[model samples]
Target: MQTVVTAERLWDGTSLHQHPLILIEDGKIDSIATHDSAPIPARAQVHDFPGATLGPAFFDVHIHGAAGHDFMEATPQALDTIGTFLASHGTSAYLATTVTASLDATLRALDGLANEMAKLPQPGRARPLGIHLEGPFLSHEKRGVQPAEHLLAPSIATFDRLLEAAHGHVRLMTLAPELPGAVELAAHATSRGVRVSVGHSNATAAETRAAIAAGAVSATHTFNAMRPLDHREPGILGTVLTTDTLFSELICDGIHTEPEIVRLWWRAKGSERAILVTDAMAAAGMPDGEYQLGGFPVQVKDGRATARGVLAGSVLTLDRALANFVRFTGATIDQGLRLLSTNPAAMTGLAHRAGTLAPGKSANLVAIDAAGNLVGSIVGGIQAS
Candidate 1:
């Protein structure tokens, strides 16, 4: 079956087309043309959004879970629930992120997640493109809600074991650069095709720079679990802001970062280097209450998710993040869309999988109003329910 999607304008992760009509066939994009130039095929199903701009669906590189199901569960049901909820909020793909846990527990969860990734993707649901290992090598002082007991110094052997369990599906790993063997681990993980992100740390600026030289390409949830910037020492936060080559993730939920800080971050990272991630937990898209984040219990009240007086994760969806970012930074909607889609995809080396709408690509995209509000989402050529 052929489907035609039309919107006021289309941003194909690069340039904009006016009055665009996209042709999707067999879950792949067949062509993109202006409505006046290319007539809609007779009998083709048309999905028209009168006042919305169409862009690539968001790619969230750091998210715990949603709809009351933690990604650490690594169950089909859990993924289905989470993925469905994510798709409705304009995310077409994500990396299932894991928190710090015991070696045995982490390995088991990795195996299960690998198995799930091997299965076929369901229609109308966001795809779990890969795994993001966010734990095991972290600083206890800045670990946030990650379990302290399970935190380990960077070890190549342990990382290899986790990678094997994941069956090479680990796309990203977060490490504390100040750890003894972190630089070596970062190099090793990069060799094995895992993009390294520096975070959950209390590292000096020099240490952060060394990690970046060793292959750390991004920073995880900047400012939340990092050393404060000092005028003399600068520290990880300063390095993350100053380094133009490094990509940085920000949880733009206003709660984690103030509007002023968000504006500052935008000014530092700019449109090319900034990536927006939810870092969302099971409480996302659910009523405020208790929810699980890895092995810990988090309380959600008025959109805040906390554990033991420390911020655990977030209940933010990417769509809301887009709106918040625009509201906070006053960036154009195109810039906000790039932060969520293009930057994350480029950071994780998954640009071919998500973050663009082009011929021969999967028909994954979203329709949004000028204010960055999600009007609709389509994944694999199926409209999100």
Candidate 2:
């Protein structure tokens, strides 16, 4: 069946087109016709958003949990619940991210996620593209919510074990590149098709450069769990901010990174290299209360999530992140969409089918009101609101 969705404005990942008519067929976009170019077919279904902006649906490559569900639970119910909640907020897909934990526990989580990812995504739910292993190989001094006892030193054998347990579903891994054997581990992970991101480390600038030389392409949640920048030595944070090729992930919830720092980082990385992520825990989309993140107790009060008096994760959604980013950076909606949609799609290796609202791409899109608020979403050509 063919369907036509029309909106007052359309952001095709580059610029906004006025009064665009998008044609979707068989879960992929067939074509895009402007108001002056063609007429809508009388027989086909038409969805008209009179005063809304339509664009590519958001993709979060680094999110943990939402709606009273944590991915570390490793259950189908948790996966489905989170996915459903994400779709309602205009998220088309996300990575099921993991945290630092015992080797056995982490393996169990990976096995469960691998099985879940193999199945088809239910209607009205976000697609779980892959897994992001955020810890177990990290700096002990910088471990935020990760238990110190479970932190492991960088080793090829352990990484191989994790790769096997995930059934090759691990798309990204975050490690402290300053640790022993980290450069070699980065090379090995890259050789096996896994992207290495530098984070949760106290690595020096020179050490960070060496990791980048070994195929580290991104920085995880910049400045939160890593070494601070210094003009004299310019630690990991300095290297990440200065490097042109390395992508930086920012948690724009206004709690993780300050609004001013967010603006600075945005200026540094721009739309092409900066990515937005919700390092959210189970408290996201739920009322403020107690929650669990990676088997540790956390307190959520007034939208802030913390553990042992330390900022643990977050309670942010990508839609809110987009709004905050626009407010902070004073960027156009078209440029902001690149951070949430284009960069993440490329980072996750889904650029062929996802990201842009173009012919032959998957019909995944989000609808925002004229005031820049999310109103609805379409996932895999199905309305999800």
What overall lDDT goes with each candidate model?
0.94, 0.89
Q: Give the candidate number with the greatest lDDT.
A: 1
How well does candidate 1 match the true structure, expressed as C-alpha RMSD?
A: 0.8
TM-score of each: 0.99, 0.97
**Candidate 2 residue-wise lDDT, 1-385, digit = tens:** 7888998889988778999999888888899988779788878788888888899999888888999988989899999899888988899888899989899999999999999999976766898888999998999989888899999999999999999999999999998989999999999999999999999999999999999999999999998998888889899999999998999999998889899999999989887999999988899999988988988889999989999999988999999998888888888777888899989878767776568888888788988775557887888888887
Residues 1-385, candidate 1, lDDT per residue (tens digit)? 9999999999899988899999999988999999899999998999998888899999999999999999899999999989899989999899999999899999999999999999998878998889999999999989999988999999999999999999999999999999999999999999999999999999999999999999999999999999999999999999999999999999999999999999999999999999999999999999989999997899999999999999989999999999999999888878889999999999989888888999999999999888889998999899994
Q: Which regions in candidate 2 have their CA more than 4 angstroms from the true location?
A: none
Pairs that collide, model 1: none
Candidate 2 Cα deviation (angstroms), residue 336? 0.4
